[model samples]
Target: MMNILKRVITVLLCLILIAVAVVYFYMKQPQFGALPEGVRLERIKKSPHYRDGKFRNLEEKPTIAEGYSLVGELWESLTKDYPRTAPKDSLPSVKTNLKTIPADRNVIVWFGHSSFFLQLDGVKILVDPVFSGKASPLPWGVKAYKGSDIYTAEDMPEIDYMLLSHDHYDHLDYETVKALQPKVKYVICGLGAGSHYQKWGYTGRQIIEKDWGDKQEVKPGFTIYTESTHHDGGRGFTSSQALWLSFFIQSPSMNIYYSGDGGYSTRFKKISEKYPSIDWAIMECGQYNKAWQSVHELPEEVAQATTELKAKNMLPVHHSKFTLAKHSWDEPLERISALSQSKNYRLATPMIGEVIRLDDPAQTFKQWWKAVK
Candidate 1:
């Protein structure tokens, strides 16, 4: 009987080892990406925000909100009511020909989630472009909504600059980067994020990684200032090896602020105090829950942040493509729209691939998601 018990224990150990091996193999795939190393590591360590081998936010933040148990939240997310997490029908979208967009026109087109195409002063900039149709390391994980992926690399024109906010799978897709490599001129991202681009075949000359508070004049009339965000970054099991950031883009014709994935913080007010006036604020307004409130902002908080930033107009993003949270997919738009109305904040709600004329600050879009069901 003792021999039989030992045999059972041996079999269980073998099974556990096999499972661990499988997981390790899967994580080593190119999609998981390489972390900052060697020279990149040295550069990251120089930042004042770097501490104890990881970058830190302005203040200490918990990944999960106060009083929330990580295990309990995960269980609830796995087995809770998540109605309308996806649209019932294909979402409505316009297929704009990027190459044909006039060089003189300043326009912005969103491709759902955090990806956006910006054309100003004949310079084409693509931000957090994930046109690969999925937002996860595995193909089945975090698939995009139907009709949301109307734009692809093939549809893109020669890009002047590609702005990557962080190294998260949703923001920095491996396949998308490879597909756009031939047409891309420069890759701009937060500190240590260029390691993944280097691993994926981009040379040092093609990438520019900046720490928080770093400013660069990319061109004669265009300047970029990196600012802090209340978030963390990593492509693999580790976290915060690189910085997460928002960008204040100053151009001759416009001033735009992009709040990469972040929770509500005093940083918004700081940005307003520094910039004085932002012509357009592309803000994150979705994929939020109390469980992860410290990382992502609630819809009301988005409105408050917009007000704090002194932005002339707000374009809500980080929704309508993938359902990362349990709330109804359209809930963000509904809530932000109502809040903007009550607070008298100007809001821009363009459909996927619909061109937004930057000069027309008063331009409005139809409630496109209302017809999705």
Candidate 2:
């Protein structure tokens, strides 16, 4: 009995050591990204929002809401039978060749999720592009829907400014950014997010790393302002090593807003006061759940944020491509469309890769998902 027990213990110890070794090496891979260090870490320490060794939100909300446990949420997400979490068939999309689109045209093209391209006063900007087909560190996780990923890095036009909202996997995919490095001129992201780009071979000169309320003029009359939002980001075990942010672009003809990913807070009203005349706002509205009400806004909060900003038109994003939450993929679109009827903003629901004329407020979009599944 003693001999058998000794053998079992030896085998278990060896297995435990192997598991630890595997994880250590896996995390060492470049995809997990480097944490804020050296000059970047020094800059992060000086931010007004930095507190207790991590960047803090103006509104202090728990990552998971009061009553939920992380383990419970994960179990429910895995075990629960959420109906239609992904479309039953290939989602309908219009692939207007991006490279062929006239450079002079003022437009916005959403590549689904939070990735999008914008041309204002002839300066082209791409935001949070994740074309790696998946949104996780592990290869098989959260794959993009069939037709949603038709747009690749090779298809993109020359990008004057690439806006990386934060360092989260879905927003900042390694494979996607590396492929577009040659065509991209500058990358505008929050304070420490530049660390990841630097590791991926993007020149430090090509990155515009800034704090919460800093502003930059990339082109004549085209100013990009980095603003605060209530979200968290990190690629490795230590999270919120950098600030999470949104952008308010002041173009010569019009103004635009992009909320990368954030929960609902009083910050929206502050943003409206700061940039009083917003032409169009692209807000994050998907992959939200009740437990994460303070992490990503529930659909109701998304509607309220739009109202507070008083945007002339709003394009609801952060949905329709990947399933990060348990809700049906079409739920975000369906809910927000219903809520917008009484709101001040006209909801712009363009199909994936379809060009939307920024000046055309009267343009209409089909309830495209209704026909898909």
Candidate 3:
């Protein structure tokens, strides 16, 4: 009996070791990316927010909401009754020829989720571009909704600047970055985020990493300021080693604000007080749940943030692409649309690949999602 028990224990230990070895090698792939090292780490260490070996938010807050266990929430999300998390059919889109669009016209195109294209003052900018279809390091993770991936790197023209808000896989896709590297003249991102680009074979000169409160003039007429956001960043098991950010873009003719991703806080109100004339505010309005309110904003909070920013027009994003939350895919759009109408806020709801003239606040889009089953 003693000899039989010893054999069973030895086999169990061997199986656990084999599993660990397999996971280690799998994570070593380029998709997992490298952490900030050498100069990148030196720069990250200098930021005031960096302390105790990690970046800190403006205020102390829990990543998961109070009284919620991450394990339990994830179990519920995987097994509970989730309704309309994805569209019943392929979503409608208009494949506009980006290269043929007139250079003088300032316009913005939504490619769904946090990715978008902006042409301001004749300079082309792409933000948080994740055209790889999947939003995770693993191929089977979070995938883009059907028909939401109409635009690809092949469709893009020469990009003047590429803006990366954070290091999260959804916001900073590895495959998409490699594809766009040739056309991208300069890459702007939060502190330490350029490490992923460096690991992916981009020259150090082509990347510009900045801390919050830093400003840079990217072109003769375009300037970008790094702003605070109440969020964390990581691609693997680690978290908050690098900075996450929002952006305040100032051009000769317009000022645009991009809220990368964050929960409700006084920071938005402070930003509005500083820059009272934001022409268009691109706000994150999806993938929110009570379990993770510390990072992502609820739909109602998005509307309130728009009002706080004093933006002339609001373009809701971070939805209609991947099902990162338990809420219905259309909930973000439906709720924000209703709130905008009641509050008399100007809203822009362009379809995927459809363009909206940035200067024209009254430009309207069809309620396309309402017809989708």
Candidate 4:
């Protein structure tokens, strides 16, 4: 009996060693492949998956809300949000069918979460393109509110610029970047995340790193300015080692402010001081909790953020897409609508694929999430 038990243990040890060797080789092989120029392997102290900062409490463990588990939230959201979801028949979601981006018109397509398709002065731009169903390093984690891949690299129009708020997976998707490198003219990101791009085959010319208070000219009429955001960045093993930022996009006829993902701060006031009349403010309005309230503002705070920026129109995003926090899936949008009306701000709340013309009157779609619950 002792001899038989010894044999079983010995085989188990051999199997474990083989599994380790297999995973190690798989990870190392990708490193040696021919990558783009200026792209090289280097270690960074952080990743772009989560918010990290000096005040960020890395040790805090998130407790799933009592009434809202991840699976239960999904169940509630689908019945409530999707069945009542208005079909965007007027807008063509395909990149191949994308109409001529009007030369002087500014169009913003809110792709749920922090992603947007902005066309200003005939220049097409995409922000924080995370089309994956789940925003996790592991496949089995919190899934996107809707199904994934509404559009992919192959479906994207001739992308002139890609603006990234920070390195968070919800913002900066590695697979998307790898596929978009060849087609993208310029990639603008906050400082320190350039290394991740370089590793994935993006060139320095293709990658532009900006710090707060810094601005870059994409063309004569289009300018991107990096401004401070309170969020932190790190992928997995590291924390707070990468820079995070919000951006002010100034085009010929429109000045747009993207809040990225940051808690409510006095930064909006500072931004308004710099650019007094912002035409549109695309701000985060969901995935918030009191514990991390400093990093993600609630819907009310989102309204205040827009007001501080002196924005004429407010588009509440970062909600109606992913379950990043413990709140009811649609609470963020519903609250922000009430807040916007009370605050007297023009809230341009469009559906996921609906287009908001800069010249058109501001409008709000029906509350579709009511159907799910």
Summed backbone clashes in each candidate are 0, 0, 0, 9
Tens digit per residue, CA lDDT, model 2, 198-300: 9999998898888899999877888999999898989988999878889999988999998879999898999999999999999999999989888798888
Give lDDT for model 3.
0.90
- For residues 182-239, could you state the per-residue lDDT of candidate 4 as single tens digits? 8788988766677678778888788887667789987898888988877777664455
In the range 1-373, model 3's lDDT, one tens digit per residue, is: 9999999999999999999998899989998778898978988888899998898998988889988998999899778999999998899998999999898999999999999999999899999999999998876788898999988998998999899888999899888999999999999888878888999988988899889898889678789999999988998888887689999999999999999999989998999988888999999999999889889999889999999898888899999999999999999999999889866468988889999999886677888999987
Instruction: List the lowest-lDDT window of 10 residues for candidate 3.
Output: 341-350
Ten-residue segment with the worst summed lDDT in candidate 2? Answer: 95-104
Which residue segments of model 2 deviate by more than 4 Å? none
In candidate 3, which residue ranges exceed 4 Å CA deviation? Answer: none
Q: What is the per-residue lDDT of model 1 for residues 45-133, given as tens digits with 9 covering 90 to 100?
A: 88899999898999897888789899998898888887888888998999999999989999999999999999988789999999989
Whole-model lDDT, model 2:
0.90
**For model 2, what is the error of residue 22's alpha carbon versus the real structure, in angstroms, after optimal superposition?**
0.6
Model 4 Cα RMSD, 1 decimal? 6.5
lDDT scores for all predictions?
A: 0.91, 0.90, 0.90, 0.71
